[model samples]
Target chain A: MDFELIAESLPRLAEGIDETLLLAGSSLVIGFVLAVPIALLNLSNNGTVRTLSSGYVYIFRSTPLLVQIFLIYYGSGQFRAELQAVGLWFLFRESWFCAILALTLNTAAYTSQIIRGGLQSVPWGQIEAARSIGMPGFMAFRRLIFPIAIRQALPAYGNEIILMVKSTSLASTITILEITAIAKKIISATYQPVEVFLIAGAIYLSLNFIVTRAIMLVEFWLTPHLRVDRRIPPVVRRTPAPVPAP
Target chain B: MELSYLGWGDAGWGDEFARGALMTFAVATCAFLLSLVFGTIFAAFKLSSNLLLRAVADVYTTILRGIPELLVIYLIFFGGGQLLQTIALGLFGYDGYIDLPVFGVGTLCIGLSAGAYSTEVIRGAVLAIPRGQIEAARAIGMNQGQRFWRILVPQSARYALPGLGNVWQFALKDTSLISIVGLVEIMRTAALGSGSTKQPFTFFITAFLIFLVLAWLSQRVFLRAEAWANRGVRSA
Candidate 1:
């Protein structure tokens, strides 16, 4: 490894970091919003909706993300005239939108499954209690059901986030000047793949470390009862000597 | 005015596509087997009493799981070449031109990622074995080798079937990424056909269907194995 070359390339690689973060962060946020409803549809009793949702998930999840990106970027361009006529070509003109669209759809398929599993694990008693309290179905689901499911789903979702962050490397294939793209350029120019990739790996490790810690904090905050109450272990609700019939 | 590029005749890509599918299967099988070996070693390390060995296993799994498959492949393909060349110079005392073949590099990358996931599955299965079973073997005067082969290995293999099946599917799909390193797998072949024929939709759809078939077939095989393994047990 050439220390001088690595030192020289640090700033340029750092510039790539911003684009990398933008690609991953934007796709993750958008993917999460889209996945929730898809998850619900997937779990619905309606056969048609369930089949359609599951098929969407299957197709997206089964194929590699690279192919999906290529299809969107190049395959869809085959219809540029038709898309342009409908005023959608403006969005499709840039590689950024294509990368985001592909990543969003792919991540959504995965996150929806994670979320569906979470919703399925919600205890039936909680929903029954909500109904007994005269709470409306939508109100009960929003307040009681969604909260518990989110907590259970947070760990898997955190894994998904890390996967997405690493996946942003694919954006480089679309000519996006993300970290990997920049690293590739640096290597071609200088013939130093090992050093550049090591730096890139370090960058990813640090970013994922921060993201994992943030999610852990969120999980802790959401389930305060699960945390050990420093004051006592289990605090066991003492009967206080039967209280003399008080 | 023509859709003959996808036809099966001399001018069509029918031949190329078929060859690509064959390559995908070969690479996937090789990589899967390599992963099983790597995974078994790492799983054993994770279960070992030495803290340093356990830590090495942990770090290996973390880096493999934490990074993208694409990045890992790139690292293996490009960095692998450089590392090999360096070692060749140092150890062999001679080096003219050193480079890892595309297939070698690709298999290494895929196997590396697959092994990380398999380590978890194998470790889980090993843990799932009832502690008493091992104790019983020991009490019966079975040696370590006998106990491992007769009891631990068979039992863990049965329990690990489902998770290993999923990993196989993952390995199958991830083979597509190796196309970047010029392996001519389904994905790369589709890409080449699309670019040359300018019919991206036709080839991409073909690639997707091939993977779907592989996934379905692998799932069936694993399910059959699971049933066979559970033969003596009472079903609930």
Candidate 2:
């Protein structure tokens, strides 16, 4: 209700943008990279590989991300000596890295399904045609299959991105000073929960809106043929239609 | 070390973990049922002839579904108690701190969010009901209530089963978020046990296994329901 209070807190909340972007960006990139192999494995010709990949997706997808975050962050700390012996403790020691790892793993599970759906939707005829022309296995996939699958997956992937952005708010619980963390801090200081959260919510909405628009643009660019037909102006086309002589 | 901590006696947290699992089941079941009621009402409103009623239902579904569940829980946890106190005072002319039980709070939070998702699922199912069937019922001169019970609700339930199952699973998984409000569900119990014993791997892995079991069993039940619902429907 206090517009002035929210107006005043904008700068402090803005400071958290870098951390928020960092959290979301790292998780999205790593999650996408991790998802590709899992997705491919899920669709593998080998039954064992397919089962293993599907099992991974099932386990990760069924559990809550909050549990995963705690398990990685605090749970990994329980194995300090062992991890230190392997020189991997440093990775888990930092809250940010742990947050990223958890989010990446979680999103990878979901994204693998999305990607697998996309990959599955590619018709067999296209692959057959490519093979008929003697397109190599890798070449055909790279040229024909991957592009089509990515286009199919883009919209779902965009939803995953927004989900991840929202998921990053969990990092605030682990002391990662993202926008939500900053909002919490501001609220504790100002004792104005509504204003702080309102401003923070606006930030999230704007960020999500921008990301959604960008993904849509990418989708548009990727499928130039799918765009609205601009071949002829309406006025020119509407002028007494020239009927073909029967 | 892990075994002792989770041992089935006073020396460990076996009882607490078991109780937490029970509480999770209790809360989820209550929330699921509540959401079903809430969903049916909202869905009926959505399908109602009144434009204003439809708009109200639409707005409820949109805001609840669009926002993250965590924010919803936070708002409820912080504001719910005060709201209850205000209501209590208005109704009974009594003013005291109204303590909402963790079960009540967690179930209500989960129910509110689940109801939003369920409203859409139920609405879609109702809309999918063939117009001819309703017309036939009308021609048969059945009362409004009878037509709804005998013809519409049953058919809609069959159609809505799969989507409602999805919403149920979503609700189950989301119950873990209620740990923040101190519901002491499986996730919270595991977190607490892991923190106390410093055996994170064991407790978390155990929690994960429990969830997998619940999810797998629920999916099987839903699949059974789906099969039963679709019985006698021929596919070419």
Candidate 3:
């Protein structure tokens, strides 16, 4: 409705994209790292190990991320003295740190489950085949199991990345100048809610589009076997030149 | 942790927290049902013969699913009222300010966003129903309505339950975003309490526990529903 307003606000909102990417990218990286061990623990043979990991995943997954964010950010204020005693007050004092920490832990809970599913879906025979080849336990797990599981997991994990990106908007609640936050600031100030949000929404859509495309590229690379070899055409048996009927 | 902060009556926030939890549940229930309506309609649109209807449905789900829930709430909160007021003023010549209630806006935004997710799930469920089943029902002289009610609904409901359960959980968690728009849901209640008490950990942890309870209870409910839907079916 306000073309001029939209043109003016574009750059202001664009500035937030860097912060958004930083928050989401960092949280996703940490979440992925944390999820691997948690996933493995969930699949562990030891009952206690499995319970503890699944409990961690369950508790995190069950609760809302906003509460988790609040618990880490403002919640730490209640324990300032204790955190100070442990010399960890500095970390707790920073809102950005808390935001990333909350997002990381939350995403890990979801990602670990995805990873667990991927790991579980790996063919049992493959592990046995690795064992038959005299592959060491860790070696087999590292090379064979991890690769196959990652490939199996990529599609689901792609959805998780989109989720994580969308979730970085939560950081705005804590004063981080992410795209959503900046958009909010602009809209509230200018009273051009439709114009401001349309731009912001477009930014998010493009971000997610890029993310999904990257995931698809990874999936394509990983699943070479699923792709047909266009370089090599399928062979068709030559038809007999002379037909007896003819 | 200060136990007195959680005490009931005028002494503490126990009553408010309970009310807040109820509010959260109420909002989630309304939003989830609203979403089912949106989902079914959009699913039908996607499945219909009209290309324009299919394109509209696709655009709805794609854009809705892509953007953050917060933005949707904000857009509805800030932009939706303005749009409605313009229409009112133009058609009815009403000049009064149309202040959209936060609860309605929040629930609508959440429902619309959740509906996009539900559309895909329901569509998938409907598509999963075997084509031959419909053909056989047709051969047996069932009308479109009969075939849809008897043959399609039951089977798709079974298929849709698990996905719908996930959507419900998503809708539940998303209610927290409504707090940003000043709705007094669980997150808002916790925030108010924490700010006043200066004991953020106690109040937020309480909020988290309440959510955990809600999620756990609903999960069991979903499992039961899934079982109910799967009646007479043999599992491998």
Q: How much TM-score does chain B earn in each model? A: 0.92, 0.91, 0.95
lDDT of 2 at B228: 84
Q: Rank the candidate models, highest TM-score first.
A: 3, 1, 2
- In Å, candidate 1's interface RMSD is 1.3
iRMS per model, in Å, is: 1.3, 2.0, 0.6
True contacts kept of 2: 0.41
| Candidate 2 TM-score over all chains jointly | 0.88
True contacts kept of each: 0.51, 0.41, 0.88
Name the best candidate (by DockQ): 3
Residue range A66-146, candidate 1, lDDT tens digits: 878887887777778888999999888799999999999999999999999999999999999999999999999899999
TM-score of 3: 0.95
Candidate 2 residue-wise lDDT, B43-154, digit = tens: 9999999999999998787666545677677667665665677688999987977667888888888899899989988999999999999999999999999998999988
Candidate 1 DockQ category?
medium
**Model 1 misplaced regions, further than 4 Å:** A230-246, B1-3, B87-99
Per-residue C-alpha lDDT of model 3 across residues B30-115, encoded as one tens digit per residue = 99999999999999999999999999999999899999999899888888888988899999999788888887888899899999
lDDT of 3 at B167: 92
lDDT of each: 0.88, 0.85, 0.93
For candidate 3, write residues A1-246 as lDDT tens digits.
Answer: 999999999999999999999998999999999999999899889999999999999999989899999899999998899999999999989999999999999999999999999999999999999999999999998999999999989999999999998999988989888899999888778877999999999999999999999999999889888997669777999987886684
Q: Candidate 3: what lDDT?
A: 0.93
**What is candidate 2's lDDT per residue for A1-246, written digit by digit as tens?**
778888888998899888988888988888889999999999889999999999989989877788788888888877899999999999999998899999999999999999999999999999999999999999998999999999999998997887787778888878999887887787677756666776776777678878889999999899998878868765544577789999
Q: Give Cα distance to truth, residue B36, candidate 2, Å.
A: 2.8
Error of 2 at B127 (Å): 3.3
